[model samples]
Target: MIEIKDLHKSYKMGSNELHVLKGINFNVAEGELVAIMGSSGSGKSTLLNILGMLDEADAGSYTLDGIPIKNLNEKIAARYRNKFLGFIFQSFNLIGYKSALDNVAMPLYYQGVKRAERTEKAMHYLEKVGLANWSDHLPNELSGGQKQRVAIARALASEPKVLLADEPTGALDTKTSYEVMDLIQGINDEGKTILIVTHERDIANMTKRIVNLKDGIIIDDSKVEQVKASANV
Candidate 1:
């Protein structure tokens, strides 16, 4: 579903170059749940941004589905991103004034989905996340778990092909972190390709496959068949 080849990105900070991604290579098949694992300053977030189409790789090829994206204009890239991607961030990114339901429906509104239909779908997603009763609550009205759930609902409401999450559980306590991961796993179970970027080993272990990075290049790739069994159990 997604492929990155020979990616290189760097930022000029004063007189020094802050190299972020260095010749990174990876591919995620359709419907797979995978994690990018790394330490601080290891470029996991940079890779996530490139994959999400929010940032460009200075030198590399990114192909989503089958289209090469290294040269897509900003407008075209944005359109493709909105049409096929769902994003969850550590900060939750919900507007303070908007209720969970309304926040979840924002993408649909951008897609020109009729108001009634979008509301119906958003509510259904909220209920799926066990937050139907809290639909009218703003982000501040919910607990950490609920806010993350609302974020998940917002991600899923658009029915995108891939879910890109960066430190999704970073703000939650241990129990709430597990809950959020479970919810993300449930979404992956229904055939969404999931790519998570995290520094936490435990969180990375939850994914079926993991790509460990250092200095931006993948140093190890391992398949955890045991995760499948554990998840089922």
Candidate 2:
């Protein structure tokens, strides 16, 4: 579903150029649950940004679903990003004043979905994330786990082709992280492609495959026996 070849990125600081991603060759098949694991400065975040279309690689080819992603006009890039990707972040990027329902419906609102249909779709996803009861609650009223659930619901509301999560469990406790990972596992079981950027070994174990990055290169890529997050929870 996704492909990258010889991906390279670098940034300049005064007169010096610091190369982040030297050369990254990667691929993720549809329905695959993969983790991109790296320590700080490993370029995982840069790769994720490139994949999310928030940043472009200095050199490389990226293809999403079959469309080459490079040099897109801002308008076209925004459209493609909205159409193809859903994001979950370490910090639950929820609006404080918006109710769970409203937050979930926000994407559809941008998609120009009518209020009635948006509400219906948002409610469906809320229920899917087990947040229907808290639809009327604001982010502050919800617990961390609940807030993440709301975020997950909001991400799913758009029905995007891929879910890009950055340290999704970093803010939660072990138990809560397990619960959230369990939810994520269930979603992947249903055949949604997911790529998680995480440094946690246990969290990486929960995924079907692990791609380890160090100094901008993949050091290890292997499929493992998937550990059930529910078992850990």
Candidate 3:
């Protein structure tokens, strides 16, 4: 479903180029759940941003569901991103004044969905995340876990082909983190491709495969997890 070859990304840092990604070759098949794990400054997040089309790759061949995206103009990239992918971030990225339902509906609003239709569709996703009752509550009224659930709901409400989660369980207690992971696994089982970037080894092992990065390079990838299911948390 996704393919990236010989990808390179660099940023200017005080006259020295910070070469974040050095020839990353990535591939994700449909219905697969993959976790990207790496240390700080290892370029995991940079890779995620490039995969999400939020950041430009200095050089690469990238295709999503058969459409080449390596050199798309910003406008075309944004259109493809909104239509084909969803993003959930570490920060929960919800509007403070909006209710959970409204926040989930926001993406559809930008996509030109009618107000009533968007609300109803957003509610379905909210319920899927087990937050239907909290639909009317604002972000401040929810726990960190609930806020993240709302973020996931918002991401899923767009009905994109893939979900990109960056540090998805980073800002939660142990219990809440596992809850979120279970929720994400459920979503993955329903056939949406999931790509997650996380620093936690435990969380990475919860997915179908775990890939490790170092110095902007993939050092390891495993289809069989070293972590047992009983210790998913």
Candidate 4:
């Protein structure tokens, strides 16, 4: 579903260049739940950004669902992002004034989905995330978990091939984190390819595979027995 080979990224700082990702190689198959785990400055976030097509790699290749992801114009990049990737951020990234339903519908709006269809798809995903009853509530009106669920629903509304979550359970309490992970696990069970970037061991264990990054390279990549988040919840 996703492929990366010899990936390299860097940023210029004044006269010096900060090498972020150095010769990283990775691949993810369809219907797999994977976690990218790293400490500060380990380059996991850079890898995520490249995988999401939010940023370009200075070197190497990335192919998503048979489409080469290099040297595209912003218009084409945005189109591919909408067509291939869904994102879940730690902060939820919801508009303060938009209700949960409206927030979920925003992506569909960008895709030029009509009002009626957008509303239908938004409500369907909201219900899937167990947030149908809170559709009218604004981000400020919901709990942290509820807000993240709304974000997840918004991400899924586009029906992208890959889901990339950055620190998905970082802000919540343990129980709430488990609940969110449970929700994510359920989504993966239904054959959605999901990649979560997190530092928390327990959260990474919830996934089927863990890719450990250090100093801009993958240090360890291994599959583990998946731990069901529902048990922890």
Which residue pairs clash in candidate 1?
A: none
lDDT (C-alpha, whole model) for all candidates = 0.88, 0.96, 0.90, 0.96
Instruction: List TM-score per model, in order.
Output: 0.95, 0.99, 0.95, 0.99
lDDT of 2: 0.96
Q: How does model 4 score by TM-score?
A: 0.99
Backbone atom clashes (below 3 Å) for every candidate? 0, 0, 0, 0
Expressed as tens digits, the lDDT of each residue in 143-212 for candidate 3 is 9999999999999988999999999889998788988988888888899999999998778878999888
**What is the C-alpha local distance difference test score of candidate 3?**
0.90
The model with the greatest lDDT is: 4
Q: Select the stronger candidate by lDDT from 1 and 2.
A: 2
lDDT by residue (tens digit), candidate 4, 1-233: 99899999999999999999999999999999999999999999999999988899999999999999999999999999998999999999999999999999999999999999999999999999999999999899999999999999999999999999999999999999999999999999999999999999999999999999999989999999999999978
The candidate, 1 or 4, that scores higher on TM-score is 4
Off by over 4 Å in 1: 226-233
C-alpha positional error of residue 101 in candidate 1 after TM-score superposition, expressed in Å = 0.6
Off by over 4 Å in 3: 226-233
Ranking by lDDT: 4, 2, 3, 1
Model 4 residue pairs with clashes: none
Give the worst 10-residue stretch by lDDT in candidate 3: 224-233
lDDT of 1 by residue, 1-233 (tens): 99888899999999999988989888889989998898988898888888888889999899998988777788898888888899998999999999999999998998899999999999999999999999999899999889989988898888988999989999988777877888787778888899988877788878899899898778999987524323533
